[model samples]
Target: MTAEFWNGTMAAAAAAKQARVQVNAAYPITPQTHTVEYLSRFVNDGELDARLCKVESEHSALSACAGAAAVGARAFTASCSQGLALMSEVMYFTSGMRFPVVMAVANRTLSVPVNIWADHQDTLVNRDAGWIQIYTQTVQEIYDLILLAFRIAEHEDVCLPALVAYDGFILSHASEPVHPLDQAAVDAFLPPPGSADRPLLDPARPLQFGEVLFPDWYPDFELKKHRALADSLGTIRKAFEEFEAASGRRYAPVDAFATDGAEMVIVGLGSMMKTARHTAEKLREDGVRVGTAALRVFRPFPAEDLLEAVGGCRTVLVLDRDIGYGTGGMVYPDVTRILYHEDHRPDVLNFIVGTGGKDITPATIERCVELARGGYRGRVEFWPDARGAEEGVPYTEEPAAP
Candidate 1:
């Protein structure tokens, strides 16, 4: 193990090299640019024995990775926001082909207004694209999960592409001390090249490629894919457990803090949940019963673990960084679905905050808890006094001048 001060981008690049990825197809984009930049340097320095393909666009980046994976090579790529949008079409094809390609997404807000900051909107748009999605809240988790992603995606029971996403700029640029595992340890955890549990395109064994399926057979093919996705939950758990045992860093699909005997629970994803946890601790000091729930694995959804975490609470407050357009925040609907059939589920409130990398401080978290106490009747609630946001001031409190 090696502990060093590293940002998310460096951590991701380092993790990829340690995981022994054979090919990295990349195109520079905000926040995610440093990830590939670091990888390129690693390859140049002869530290990583891999092929780095500098592509023209994000679409071509993922397409190149898919091509490499087709030839039984361990492949990786990184993107954010518009980059993710461009790669969307290829993303579905990669999953449908059952290629175990791993991608790192620096989650950012989508365009039209032309904002490039931290938000979940980009990845949420492709939620049903048949790829496993994992969100990391800290720099350490970013490094650890990217390493684990290869193992989980290449598992025989789940040969699907996976994306490890973290808040753009927030987690991506913020530096922290991470104890990265040595290459030997990672090699032990993952399979070598051409030995992954996925179908390959070797010339020796000529096989039919992804042919157009007739209507009669298409549904069954999709059904089987869906079943594989559902069964991946067990594989995810097993990988996390093994990683924890080897590294002594515990992780879970749904991570809960002080939820046992709490009256109110705040549920969210990414680094904002760390802020919520701090707020929960202060609220507890004030004799308030509060807890925090952070969803790590977004794709598998971890409905059972989520229900177990918040089932005893009197109220569940969902804080989302992305919206679902016509309905409400993306995560809110999922939470409601988990408790939909329960006769005595807690009242759930949804608040969309921190879009486009708006600051979500401890004060903001406190405000959310207070609002939830007063009761909310709306489907989705924005930050209180959101008119200021329309005027370019998203945060209620201004930072003190130096």
Candidate 2:
């Protein structure tokens, strides 16, 4: 393994090269364009012998990847926000067809307000599209997960596409220390392209794919997809274990911090969790029993691990970078669904913060803790709320005077 400083985009490209990706089909999109660009450079330099296919649109980018994977080749792509929105149609088909194509999603906010910065709105909007979604908190995790995503997606028990999403601009541009495994170790870990275990699109096999199914059989296919995702949880754990054995760093479905005997807990996803962890530690020093839990894997839902992380707390503050409008924050509803079913559920509250790349300071987390302690549980609370209309300048990540 080699350790060096790498930005999230560079790390992803490095990981893809190490995985020996046979093809990379991608379109240029903000925050994600550099990943494929780096891969293209690698291919051109003869450092990595991969076919870099440049497509016109994000949809075609993923479609080309799906086509490559169907032909039993390892493929990758990268996009964010509008790019992902455009690719939504193919995203479902990619998973439904059981292609093991992996994509790096530098998550950004959606439109209507016309934003182009970091947020979970992009990925969460397509949460049910059937891809294995793993959110990363750092450049190292992003690199490591990209390597591991291939193994998870291509596993016989899974055979599903996976997405490694990180906050756009934040992790994407930020450089950090990363330990990347050598190609020798990676080759031993992953099977070569067009391996017999993967489905082939060769004329010799003459197999059909995505044939029109009648209504009677459509639901069965959907159910099988669900079952395959559920069953893949076991495979996910096995892959994490193997990765941990090879690398000294350990990973879990939920990354928990100082939860033991805590009175309250904060739950979130992606880059904000690093800030949350610091907030939790500061709160601990202030004699507040607070802990933080960041969800790593979103597709399988990691229900059991999440429950264990926040079950004992008096209140659980769920933070989200995006709101689901009338319903509230996305993670809040799901967390409540599981918590409400338990015999004794903690008071789980949802608060939306750091949307469109706003800095989620320690003070903001402190405010959340205070509100949770004060029994404030009603609607989705917006952070950095200033005197203004909903469609005003303050809503953006513009600096506001204290």
Candidate 3:
């Protein structure tokens, strides 16, 4: 197939169309609006034979999808940031019901003062919502992972919801060359609609869904869901291998670059890792043994794969785009916890960067490397120093020196 120019939204919409999604329910939200808009066009033009539910709110949109999935439909939806937060209540409901609903999250910062840009805060905050979270670095990955999310989510052993997230404007609005799979190829890769054998809320079968579970059964069911997510790691790996066999592209939970004999390795998730990898390569050229490892699968945590990637390095600099308020970087603690019990653990430093649309340039990553090399004492530090301003000055303005 020939490569076509597409932004992240188009790629995601194309993948959902190719997957033969039977139902798409979404309320328009920035960064995410373009994807649903494209899907709406596909449905209106008869290019895709799917029900387009224009819901009243993001919560209603996911509820519509969950209802569709409950009846054994191949359902999909897209939302990010505040929209995703609105969908939070239903997110747990959908996952608890074991619906194979797939959602595309255009990673955005949650608003307090209302800002729209790229960050992992929105999705990372929902990491424990029982949905398989997959982060992407490129438009092609957004396309591939959305397709794979359906396959993985619908798998009988992994009948849980999945989220494929990519940077909001960084990839969502930016165009890139993408070789999209044909419908035939996708149909071959993904099971035909209604092929998955699972308990569905059917009039004929009369299965109950979302029933109020008392405390006695609630904990057990929750345990089952937890085990299912943990066990789905193997199923996800199998799906990745199968997808690679079908398409010439390969994917893994953790993607490592130039880490063979590196002393310092940068670790991160989403689109910023592209910059981190480039920075690592440049540093290597300048006689600095730096490498990068990106976590593609965030929910399952991919601890072993990540351990293998950065285990040999002397220092692991974690570049997190989201802050955990009182705690620290969202991903930093996970990396530290994973390496804490290791026999030869690397020194891990967390640097929060690119919040609320701040650009994560190569220089930003270089600065992180410089700090890590200098044996910085702080466990967590914000790039560009959040406290750079004098007490009386606004953060946006330059501080007057004493």
Candidate 4:
């Protein structure tokens, strides 16, 4: 793969700029703002042949995108946190109508106290929507994954909207060497939405897209969406294979590193997986058997790969940046899905870190291994406090800064 350097936000933003979209509409929010901003300039300066729409709000941004793509135009948008929540209704309608409108979400913690930081709560809340969701673990992955997202979402069989995300400040602002990707090569990979392919929006053959569905047909559509979601697992693998062939860099629903012979492992999504990988290597060097996996694609929850990856490990620790309110954390319950279904299960430890862009240092990872080894299975393991334990926090990547 060609190598280069870019911050996560820039990589993602540049991907949007590079991809051949026909129309762009979005309301800016921190972290996700750079994407639409770059596209707006791209359109203004004649770099891209597309309409750059200025919208009043997140809802209008998505509404415009849906309207454009419905008219046979390739469309996209980006936002996060409160902005995503604000467009939550339109988000559902966009997907239900089966428009291939792909969005980039800067995953962030929802505000009550008005904090601007990274978390998965905003995207996770829309998990029920009929959208194909994909998560990333690095800036490089973020750059590449968006390319895949468009091709997958626009496929005739899929026709589902896609949401690609990276943690807000963690990955969005975090710098990493990444390829900008060859635009000519990308065009070759994904040709413009050809006529025979899909979305017969020809005025000569006018069609009604989303008619009202009652109980009988609603269930069928819902079943179709469910099957399509399941179908995406295979589609993603096929897409990755194609991407690997084209880019020469392989990816998977679950990307594993050095798991063999390890007695324990850690699982996490977004950029925190990078910290977990470094922590694993350090633990291995210290004679503590360990390995790590970036739980890259959360939606079709890579059940097979995850089960196989951690099956041999006696202990597995999962880190969730978003808490499921009274349920401690989300990943634990999802992990329990496999742990319960499997004949063999690892002793899974749940750890929450980097909730609000708290630096997830290696020391905290080591401590987590120690705590799990010590047989501590507290539902919520708060991060260490120098003077006293903090109530709201589930765990810190390090001792709280004094």
Task: After superposing candidate 1 on the true structure, give the runs of residues whose Cα lies further than 4 Å from its correct spot.
Answer: 377-380, 388-402
Looking at model 3, residue 186 earns an lDDT score of 90
- What's the TM for model 4? 0.92
| Candidate 2 lDDT over residue span 159-196, tens digit each | 99999999988999999999888787888777776673
Candidate order (TM-score): 3, 1, 2, 4
lDDT of 4 by residue, 155-210 (tens): 77777888898989888877888865688778766657423166655688888777
| Model 4 lDDT, full chain set | 0.79
Q: After superposition, how far is residue 124 of candidate 1 from its true place, in Å?
A: 0.7
- Residues 49-78, candidate 1: write the lDDT tens digits: 999999999999999999999988999999
How many Å off is the CA of 214 in candidate 3? 2.5
Which pairs clash inside model 3?
none
Question: Clashing residue pairs in candidate 1, if any?
Answer: none
lDDT of each: 0.88, 0.87, 0.89, 0.79
What TM-score would every model get versus the actual structure? Answer: 0.95, 0.94, 0.95, 0.92
Clash pairs, candidate 2, are none
How far is 51's C-alpha from truth in model 4 (Å)?
0.6
